[model samples]
Target chain A: MAEEMKVIYERPRSWANKVTHYCPGCTHGVAHRLVAELVDEMGLLDKTIAVWPVGCAVLGYEYFTFDSVEAAHGRAPAMATGIKVTNPDNFVFTYQGDGDLASIGMAEIVHAAARGWPITVIFINNGNYGMTGGQMAPTTLLGQKTTTSPLGRTPQTNGFPIRVAEMLAQLDGPAYIARVSLDSPVNIRKAKSAMRKAFNAQVRGIGFSMVECLSTCPTNWKLTPVESMERIRKEVMPYFPLGEFKVAQGVL
Target chain B: MSDKVLMKGAEALAEGAIQAGCRFYFGYPITPQNETPEYMSRRLPEVGGRFVQAESEVASINMVYGAACAGVRVMTSSSSPGISLMQEGISYISGSNVPCVVMNAMRGGPGLGNIAPAQADYFQAVKGGGNGDYKRIVLAPSSIQEGVDLFVDAFELADKYRMVVMVIVDGLIGQMMEPVEFKTKVDVSTLKTPEWATVGRHGRDHANVITSLTLDAAGLEKWNLKLQAKYAQVERSESRIEEYQMDDADYAIIAYGTMARIAKTTVRVARAKGIKLGLLRPITVWPFPAKQLQAYAPKLKGALTVELAYRQLFEDVQLALCGKIPLGWFGRGGGVVPGPQEILAAFEEQFGKGR
Candidate 1:
């Protein structure tokens, strides 16, 4: 009898391994896997509660092995803040994209951080909007062509991309803030680690924690899935650098 | 069994929450329902409670969302514009399935219409104000007494169903004070909150998730169906209506919350004028008493709806009547109240033939 070979990079049983509704080559699948991995690694499979955003990955709840909720546009942080505060025992995280986090939800995110609510926020900073037909996001890079930005982003009119990690790093309440990209395996590892660290900080009774992942959107970027991965490394990384933007020393 | 206190329709609602062991109150100051948070601010602090006057309407509702997640009894008050601003947060709470009481002291509006009483926000209160498919259990208070009664009912329904309960009142009803008594005192704080409450993760094994997102069309469908079931259950179990004089009358009026109060006064005046009018006031508009109203539809001549708006709830009365019964309406905007006499005139014009 021939020896059976172990499976390669297939769905992890702990992740429910169901087919995701994502368009080909979307990095949200990768980000979601990393989170499910951490939930399993930390033995939070049954206990983890995730708040999903109202963007491309809105059905993020279906891809996971744990409990999830869909928040209104720009209100993931507020909803997660509620879940974390009310059910302080659960592992709470909000998976939000650029438009949901930076554009409409600016008020909720700022105040949740300012109040030092103990929670974790996973912000996926793709350059343009994804779910609502690729409108320009607050994090849209200069000269990025999107449905809303037909002539590329104009600094004179649309303003520059927002560095959310940098902006949030200055806040006194946020316990951890890291910005990482999902361009390659090595960076994906770093992004995954950043997410674990932020969640672990909240688990330790630390204050608001966030990990900003520079993700990819092939459909919106008008690139193939392969090219989408390539752009993250070749173009996107050059603009949004990878690093640990903030950490509350001795707190975690 | 607690001591009785004289209160306004609005104060009765606030005191009812207090008596029910409510502990958190967050809201923006709008006219009409200002007494709710004002009473909560002073009263909550005295009884180990928390009251926060939020920076804006948005902040206040979100703050309630935050506190409720922590397993506390939380609520907020707002008028029309402020309530509209709170739609985002209210949607969040509904999606999350976090229970909290939202008091809408409705005034006239499309845009800051008036400070006069109006029930124009019928669509907003019943339909999930924010995006996504959901509904709130809208409790309409018809009297100074029912104002207090609905708060207790709201907390019960909010907790029972694990959804947002709107104690929708109008300006005139909220601002007016009257004597009311609790037939029975309920120890609201003693009622055990669900294990899902996120008070603290310490020494716990379960991590609860309270959210409204269902990423896939199928997954979203599952959640929506579940919500519909809950709403159906609410409709079957919690819907309420008050029938003041439907025994021999040909026409009945269908109104709720503050509109019902003005409607009642209109009913009395219209009746005295030899119009055999009876009031069919709905206490809860969301799980609307459609079945009850439909029973009277075949026999009714017409229905008069006295709301605080021009076009707000006229449609609902029409919907309940289902084109089988003709519907008439009367009202004002902002906080301008509908005079009982004006409503009576509209009633006479619309249904005078029956008399």
Candidate 2:
């Protein structure tokens, strides 16, 4: 008989087999994997409807096996709310970038959270507009240089970075709000756990839930993938502290 | 005995939508159309429907987009300025090929001109207001009763073509009250959820994904061509016009919405004064009554286009009967409503004072 070798690990069932358009070592792929894994692990592959934002992840619908819709830039939260309210039994979530969510989509996100629409939001903050070729974003830190901020951002010129999680946690609508990073394997596990709780919040029909992933963008940051991870660990993590900001009772 | 009830135009249109099986309404309050959202807020919940007063017209249309993607009957109402804000979402909905209804209570425009009634958004509605080569089926209702009746056709046409069906009326129609009978009550329970709706995968072999982004040039071109073909079919089959007293008429006055309603009185006035004038009102403005107007070009000496905006409706008449007939134009802007007698005066002035 042949050697009784068995597969130890396999790809998540909810993840599609298509190759992603993300650049090498881009954390968007990592974030996508985490979402797909949770969608599979939580048995939400069939009922989940992903609202893809108008950014690098505009084509995010392709990465998942579940149903999806593409929303206009910064309107993903409103669109996801539309999907959730009309089909209350279906699971709806939006995947957005910092510029898409924290910049142009501020009102939509704020109002959606305030309305307490039971929807999950996976916000990827990399301090720049990655799809539009690295412009300074609302989440861009002071003294960080982007294509739009060649001399480094200053509060006098570019407004200070927004702490989206902390701000959203102030709202009474969100049942869970957390900030996590994808810098290391340990932190990646933590990010995944936070994502699970956020999903669980929606699954339990608690309220609005969000996980702001402090991700890296090697191409936009003009740094090596290793340096990007280090930058998140040293710089991004300080401004956007990693931890749960709001947790409703019984949202484990 | 008739069962018609006296209802405000905005409230009647809302009830018409509910009767037409539209269970999802998302809109922001705007002048001349605020009663629509207010009525929907109370009515939708009573009928086991959903109502969302969005933060802005942008959010409202996006919510409409979202509900439409889930393959349900959804709608939104706004005036000129608010409708301008909705153009982006409308374009996305058109590009994504989802079905929804939108109502525009025409008001003075260019920018927040006034809350008074005007038909300045003709180009914005009948013509392509949003980017790209997309078309919306625009229904111009001239009266409160007609506006209420058109809501049924609006939702039906939206679902039939998977395109946006706009019911356009002047602010007067939105604010006015008239005896209206809800002739059609579309049992919402009979409506089937579309197969393309992004509700969930269920047990399907493939998941449904609704998007308008076609990265490849050839793919986008293909999509555009497909949309153009659908528009061509709509234009060929769906053009609607009402010819009021056109038989043996020496002149015709072409108009729509409130302008056409006044033009009907103008027709009676001009005929009484022996001008033999008739009114040609376009009910479906986008799939414009071009062919109907073209047919009358040979019979009439001339046709005068009247509107609430300067030369907006005339542009379409010019395009349709440019060389075939002598075309005349008369309009007022900035919330000016010309009386029937004034329109008759303009018609006589343009058509050489009594043929």
Which candidate leads in TM-score?
A: 2
All candidates' TM-scores?
A: 0.81, 0.99
- Model 1 C-alpha lDDT per residue in residues B177-249, reported as the tens digit of each score: 7778865556655667568764433445544455555457998788778888998898888878899778988
Highest-lDDT candidate: 2
lDDT of 2: 0.93
lDDT of 2 at B153: 94
RMSD of 1: 4.9
Model 1, residue A107: C-alpha shift (Å): 1.9
- Of candidate 2 chain A, the 10-residue stretch with the lowest lDDT total is A1-10
lDDT of 1 by residue, A121-204 (tens): 889998888888889999888998889889999899899998888988889989899999888889898888888889888888
Candidate that would win on DockQ: 2
True contacts kept of each: 0.31, 0.88
lDDT of each: 0.78, 0.93
